[model samples]
Target: MSEQTPALSLPLIQPSQAQKHVTHNEALMRLDALVQAVVLTRDSTSPPADPVAGECHIVPSAAVGTWSGQDHALAYFDGTAWQFLTARPGWRVYVLSDLQTVIWDGTAWAGEATSLQNLSGVGIGTNSDSTNRLAVAAEASLLSHAGAGHQLKINKSVATDTASLLFQTGWSGRAEMGTAGDDAFAIKVSADGAVWNTALSFDPASGFASGEAVQSGPADVTPGRLMRTDYGYGPGNVLGVVSENAGIPTGAVIERGSTANGDYIRFADGTQMCQFNATLAYISAGLCSAAWSYPMIFASGSMPNVQGTLDSDSLALTAPSVTVAGVTGLTVSGLGSTNVTLNVNTLAGASFGSGESVDLRVLAIGRWF
Candidate 1:
């Protein structure tokens, strides 16, 4: 390991007599120059602080944001561990939930919508309000039917003042009012409507309720045909039916006479004239020669269809001779002249012959159907 190198001759000073060295700054400057040749500093002239307690270091606030191991990326300082905040993301403001997997509102978490609907579709049972009541599907009744009972059907739109449930054992399985005969069962009400009763009335023409009894007459009584029978009177056999529909309270009408009590006659305006009869017949002429205030339309609605007849028993005819026009039955005279010469029984098509020589011939032709 010892290799001897040649050195030029120099004056050898002994250790006891070394001369004093005076250049301290000159050596420091030379050491700095050598350090700058390897690692350059922005301010290499400034001296570093002591490594044990570094209070003398001064760095810009921006420089503290960076670091690199032992030497900070920027300036380093007293007891502070360097954090590179400017190079990384900032702190988060919003909160998140791991369990709910929703963005937290801090107060509560919100979710996405699932259902929305219109009024028609959101009704109780039926989608629309027109159907029956929306009840529990196939549920039992509030009061189960122990024996034979009825069920009430309800409407669907029972929101406000809806009606109560209507119950009916509706119609029974059997038919009513059989065709054998008229049982004559009828709904009868009291004078006041507070009470109603099922009553029966025997009809004579129906032969003990065998058929229907028209309020007009018995079966033998034909329209425009006069029959005399005492319902409950001595001379009340003088009964007759007009060919027109008449009042049930009133017997058949007859436009037979003239002046006031007449048959088949009309007021200035044509209405119907009739006699209401029960215990006794009361002659109330609606359509007469005079004006009737309230006029009713005849069932036929026309003059030719209006039917009437004359009977010598019901009417006291007092005329000598009256001429009836062929179809019109219009009499030229004889308003009211009672003599012993009037004959009411006559054949069809010629109730009275047209005679210009006569003053009046009990004329009645409006009775022709």
Candidate 2:
């Protein structure tokens, strides 16, 4: 037969003992100070100057005055003297100063419900479902950083999985943005929550964006889309080697090349031009003929309009004669897309003497596509 309670150390009356009333009364006093006990504070390191009867306090570490060497003990003042109770592990006490319940864990006291880790669900002002394990029904939710910066990341299990933020109106989705159904980022919109329209998308590897909302008109009436190198474009771009295409009144910026035959330029709108310069000797008085080949061939079945001009000193002077002959007329015959024949006539019906030459500049314009 033990003489004290195992849990609270409450004294028990001994059988066949003298003065049983004294032992019973001591047990009662102990019970009065302990059952449903409360302490004034756990922060006081010294005894109160004037403590009333039944008043108690949980003595903290390094206690001074009459409480020296009584750290972590429940100090109870019973009328004429003080009684100290040794708190055991898992003992709970209502702290009046802190207005909360604290529990002893052999070492120190701490709030009863401060640590809530590994909870399956948590709801604030709402009920949490299985899918939405942590639901917060509030006007706004803020996730701020502790020191520097913050990032809200939504990750998916696989590339084909969706991870996005959806904006809603009256519980109906209206807009969404993120990687949906694939790795590429996409922005989609819905009017009635039934039919969805992909307004924009970005490639994951190249980051190139594409959408039907991209404008393709010539005027600056709307926003524009990114231009592809192969797409047809109007003037005012870089000059490069590009294939010809049709669709607008404007043409390519400039697609040009040079070769032994002649230099040629083509545009997106099928416009082509060729320039060439050559020297010829007169076959007879007042006439000379030569064939001109284009550097680049034009579209088939297209005849180019040709024009020519003679250099200032193109008509050579006769060896013995000092008079200089000038060009009078120039004509193009046997017109073709790739080549043409040019004829030149000099003023005063002058002819180039033997071993003499005249310079001719020619221009031809037509279609290339």
Candidate 3:
């Protein structure tokens, strides 16, 4: 039979051997240093100056003194002398210097992984609870890509569910941004944390945006409010009519209308104009008068300036009279906001019979408000 065991190379007692306890005690001593192994350090080249009995170390490369030529071996000090043991692959030892477990991989020692999957929680410099599964308490945290760019996404289960980043002060929410309470991306703010105001939101389908803080209409005129793109004159509503409620101009940029006798144009800036054609009948030599209503009335209590000139294509003279067929003077009487009377004067006292045609083009300009 062999004298030593095969696996550990422990010396076996021979039938005729005397002092067999020496070999048996040596086996126990080696087990005392190796089982559930721990090392004082894996980087000490020289042995300790005053090591206690039962103290153990893993001798490093280029070792000196009593540990010379014992690289990668476990050194155990037992009372008066030192003993060495060869380590094998799959041997695990707790390193005191690094406070971690390392395994021998035949060539070098490497850290042994404690756990890698299905962890209950992970906390770095902090304690994690059920709500916060992976919490990190630090000045900053980074999640970088292994290669190329990185993206951090927060997803929700449904459209009505919230997925947002909330900013807080003293644990009370002050602002938040994301898809909150709906699919639309929204930013909301609060002063007291109880009342929240939606500052902005975007439509998911059309990518258009709206908000409560945006200016509602042109009359809002308040400084520092966000302007809505559809507030005033814009695509599809250009030159559309504006409205007035109690003299306050509201709605689109311009207003206009056309009639058989005339046309009127009104603007958002309170300006208005009316243009029309009227026919006057010559009553006598120096007087021709006509009355007509304005297509659009000016603002109440305001009188519009009316001007007239004869249409060159629509003038006539009495058959038996020879008078210059041109108007020398034009004046307006009975003037009001909505109507006017036109008086035209021919060459003074020139003979012209009654009932002759004199077509005049009239224009009035004033305020609409």
Candidate 4:
């Protein structure tokens, strides 16, 4: 007690402590007495929250994102991004264009430096589309208006042997075959013209095959004849003939039924050629089937008339039967008497049975009297 005589009692009220005491008193004060504007610093309704009493933070906001004086946005370069506010950090708005959007998402614009060579227009300009050209196989064929109606045209200058190739064309188009004088053969798909389905099929009586190549077939449908449209047996494929060989003569010269004018073979001159006298029969070069040396011998009346070959007898006729060595295709018809003497130079008749017959004629001319 004697050593502390120099020390005197000291008192200091700290400002921080006094402030804490006052705050505590305010919190505990009556609810009615609490100040109303005290919570304005942390409003729950507006964005960019109000800064707290001593907070020194910077928060982004609406007008700061994409707003300008008179426009929604303007490019202002802060030494780097020329006013690309929407693209700033914390914002995740993407863009659409020919690839790179210059204005906004879904805009028909492109970057001048990396995309369009040089283009300017309302929508996606011409040059902008070049970057997105169609791929090789990314096109639809047989479709109209494709590539804006440009067609796949085939022009023939020389004498084309269409027999070796099957062709097709655009919608309502035909592969036309033309000839100088006569076409050896001409058929567009199944009909005369490539575009015609079964409609161009000639009626049974319109015989118009001439001695010239151009004369046969359905005009432009004649082989070597000029066709204009795609030759489709149906609407999708080409003009091709299908043979089952299901029911035909073995030795018979198997061939396509030639159209002198259209589809149906015309009974030239007369539609009524009675199978008068099936003179002789023989096997041709092609084999008929797997069995027998050359398939089974055909019953005369079974096969339809072989048009090109069919001769009539003047009497008990004592001559060698026609040799159908390499006869390609054959057709047999009436036995009307022709004064043209039979000889080697003649293209012989394709025989049916001896008297095997079929009545020929369009009109209802009562049974051969």
Among all candidates shown, the one with the greatest TM-score? 3
lDDT of 4 by residue, 166-251 (tens): 44444333443333223333333433333432112222244433332332322235555433223213333222332222332111
Question: In model 1, how large is the Cα lDDT of residue 278?
Answer: 10
Which regions of candidate 3 fall more than 4 Å away from where they truly are? Answer: 2-9, 221-223, 232-265, 275-305, 309-361, 366-369
In order of appearance, the predictions have TM-scores of: 0.15, 0.73, 0.76, 0.18
C-alpha lDDT score of every prediction, in listed order: 0.27, 0.78, 0.80, 0.26
Put down candidate 1 lDDT per residue, 1-369, tens digits, no spaces: 212112211123334543513133333332332221212222222324332222222122233223223121112222343211111111111112212222223332234233664323333333434453233333443656767986755343423333332222332222222112333332232333334222323443553421222223533454433332321112332234333224221233333333332323432212344321111111121101111111222333223222223333332222222323212321122222121122123223433323212112132221122
* Model 2 per-residue lDDT tens digits across residues 1-369: 999999878888888999999888778877887889898899999898889988999999999988899999999888777788899998899999999999999999888976679778899989988888998999999999988999999999999899999988998999999998899899898999888888788899999776555444443235445554334353445576545324443434678888998788887567889998876555665557788888888779889888888655435342211124445556878889888888876567445455555567888999887
> Best-fitting candidate, measured by lDDT?
3
Ranking of candidates on lDDT, top first: 3, 2, 1, 4
Give me candidate 1's TM-score against the actual structure. 0.15
Model 4 residue 197 lDDT score:
28
At residue 79, give the lDDT of candidate 1.
39
Higher-lDDT candidate of 3 and 4: 3
Error of 3 at 136 (Å): 1.3
The RMSD (Cα, Å) of candidate 1 is 29.9
